[model samples]
Target chain A: MQILIIAAIICLALSFFADRGKTIAGIKRGGVMLLRILPALLLVVFLVSIFIYLVPEKVITGYLGSNSGAMGIVAAALIGSVSLIPGFVAFPLAGILISKGVSYTVVAVFITSLMMVGTLTLPLEIKYFGRKAAIMRNVLSFFGAIIIGLLMGVFF
Target chain B: MWKILDNFFLLLRETIFFLPLMFLLIGLFDVWVPREKIERHIGYGSGLAGMFWVILLAVAQPGPLYGAFPVAYILYTKGASVRNIFIYLGAFSCMAIPMYAFEIGFLGVKFWFLRLIFSLLVFVSIGFIMERFVGEDFRVREGR
Candidate 1:
């Protein structure tokens, strides 16, 4: 909240130099842009809320253990791809997975996929970058996650 | 009805908080920043310097993936190279600097560094591939 205020104040101040008229116009343009993206952003937020709160944690951790093997990696990749939990939550959750004997490699895949490929944001991504770029990036990152996982297994 | 509204209510606070601020910045940029200025800095001839420049910017920002989309589209319109913009999004989501210290503490130094290195390489490759796949005609004015 403080950060937003600071940014808002700075923008207003800077706009004085940029042009008072243009700044007001900018604020209006910003409002319209906000409205344009609102529906899609809300959809993503809703999906993230459901996936995080509704899905059983045990189901996730259980299938993601080291002994869980290929399926474990796949499960981790799938969950990580969609769940847009913050870094604090995600890293601690990942650490717990490692401690619980989940494969380090699987955890690597999980974190990599979680960060790089936002499956939930596909609508917004497609709306901006178009279908081919959005789909390709996600698809490639999925495989890249698997490769990183395999490498981690070999190295550590 | 209850379930749907329940979910909506749950996320309403955050949506109200962040979206306007994001759009405000975007609006400011839209109004003030010159297209030629952006194009020269991060556009076609900018080369590796542009990728690194954008990565630094992406790392400095602390926002979710959706936030990057609009900023990226703006950059693209203003003449950022296709590949570099994609790399920026990749770095923004994958290896954000705000999250770096936290990541190292939890994931350990070796693990974090390894992921960082590999993710950068993968994203650059992805960017080039995307550049080829989408080609020059993908610009906003051309498409519109």
Candidate 2:
């Protein structure tokens, strides 16, 4: 995060040297956008933290680990879509699931949906891309995850 | 309560730290990149090549998924096609290069390779599907 901030500052400084007025204008524009999205950002972080707290990892693994049919894939996809686990944790959990005999399809759907769909981030997404586009993207990605999972089941 | 608050503050701090830099960079993108260039590369007529460009752009970007939203917004204003924007979002969410390296480490090279191929196929189709639903007139709501 510090690296990103430093890099951004350096780029901004370079831009300032190239054209001062445009650089100022860019900063002002960014400031407006930051203020606009602040409420949604705060709300989402709060809600996600609460959700993560309420649902322990064991419960999530229990749900995904137990089921094994078509229902299992759906369950895994749903959990993945809603859960806030980071990639580091999610991939390891997925590895454990595979070792536990979960079908490739279920694990595939779980990881794909976790990465592609963001139920909690919808508020922030809507704030930027509008209600329609944001919702459509998630809906599409959900189905996409399923399709990808099914194909993986066929291949592996 | 304390746990939730602690988690909340941690997530909030992460966002607060990273998002401004995202916005600042996006603002610079909006200012420096000409609309016509964006149009030519990922606009209405950019075709299949546009998808390729967006996937590469998405891979190059390094950040949490939320950071991609504002960049997508700027791309839209600069006249990137709806399909291309959706593709960008899908790729940004799933196909990031750094994330791919981690995925390969945990899931094995075969799993990572197959998932990427499948994800690319599905997301390209999703992008096309969303273009139909979202269409050209979709605009970010003005008043919060």
Candidate 3:
């Protein structure tokens, strides 16, 4: 926490030096941007948290738990692709799944895909990188995530 | 209606807690970090140096993948190397300085180290593969 504070302070100081008279205005502008986006980001987080709290592990495990086989992998990947959970929440969720007897492979797939592939963000990616590159990257990442899961299965 | 109201309040709370700091960081980057400097470091046709520059950019960047990934895609189409693509993805995943700070705080130093190592390995490997096989044509139809 202290380190975070320090890092922020350093960034602020650097900005001051780098921008001269603009630093203060820049920060104020940033604050305004935050004000605009914070509501949406927070709302999403809260909804996800609610889902985490309210949904039983068994329910999720039943659908994509390790024992579900190929279907499980597909289910896990799909879930991961859609869900935009933060890393902070993702780790604990993985722990919960493990405790609930979800397969480590499925969990690995889920987490890997969650971090790498973003179905929800596809349009933005396409707009930014072009359709071909965006699609290719996501497809490759999807496969790569599965490969990682398989490797985890073999090793762990 | 009640559930919706409650959700709204919850989201408000989270935003109030986290967004201020994030916005400040973004603001700082916008104000201080010159576009020319970033371009020189990671711009089109920059090659390996550009890749390093992007990694540095990612290290300093804040926010979720939803926003970052698209920007990366744009950069790639605009002429960033596959290596730089890898660096962008890798840095975005685990190396953002703020993210690193958070990871250290929550998961400890060892976890952060492992994550950094793993992320770099994965990204570099992907980059090498893309460069070797995909070449420059990896992007969608050129000339928009």
Q: Give the CAPRI class of candidate 2.
A: acceptable
Query: How far in Å is the alpha carbon of B42 misplaced in model 2?
Result: 7.6
Measured with C-alpha atoms, the lDDT of residue A144 in candidate 2 is: 87
DockQ of each: 0.32, 0.37, 0.33
List candidate 2 stretches off by more than 4 Å.
Answer: A1-67, B1-45, B141-144
lDDT of 1 by residue, B21-130 (tens): 65676677667764444444543445877787777667654467877887787767767888877887888888775455445545677887888888888888888887
Chain A TM-scores, candidates in order: 0.60, 0.58, 0.63
Q: Tell how far residue A50 is off in model 2, in angstroms.
A: 20
* Least well predicted 10-residue stretch by lDDT in candidate 1 chain A: A48-57
Per-model interface RMSD values are: 9.5, 9.8, 5.8
* Better DockQ candidate (2, 3): 2
State which candidate has the highest TM-score: 1
Candidate 2 lDDT tens digits, A58-146: 65546555444677889888998997765644664566456556677889999999988999988988888788878888888898898
State how far residue B67 of model 3 sits from its true place (Å). Answer: 6.3
For each candidate in the order shown, give its overall lDDT on alpha carbons: 0.72, 0.74, 0.64
Judging by TM-score, tell me the better candidate of 1 and 3: 1
Q: List the residue pairs that clash in candidate 1.
A: A66-A102, A66-A103
Summarize candidate 3's per-residue lDDT along B1-144 as a digit string, tens digits: 366567546544533443455456667766666445665556555566666778777766555676566666667667677667755875676466644543444334554565455556666666676567666556633232
Cα displacement (Å) at residue A130, model 3: 8.6
TM-score of chain B of each: 0.65, 0.65, 0.62
What is the lDDT, from 0 to 100, of the residue B61 in candidate 1?
49
Measured with C-alpha atoms, the lDDT of residue B74 in candidate 3 is 68
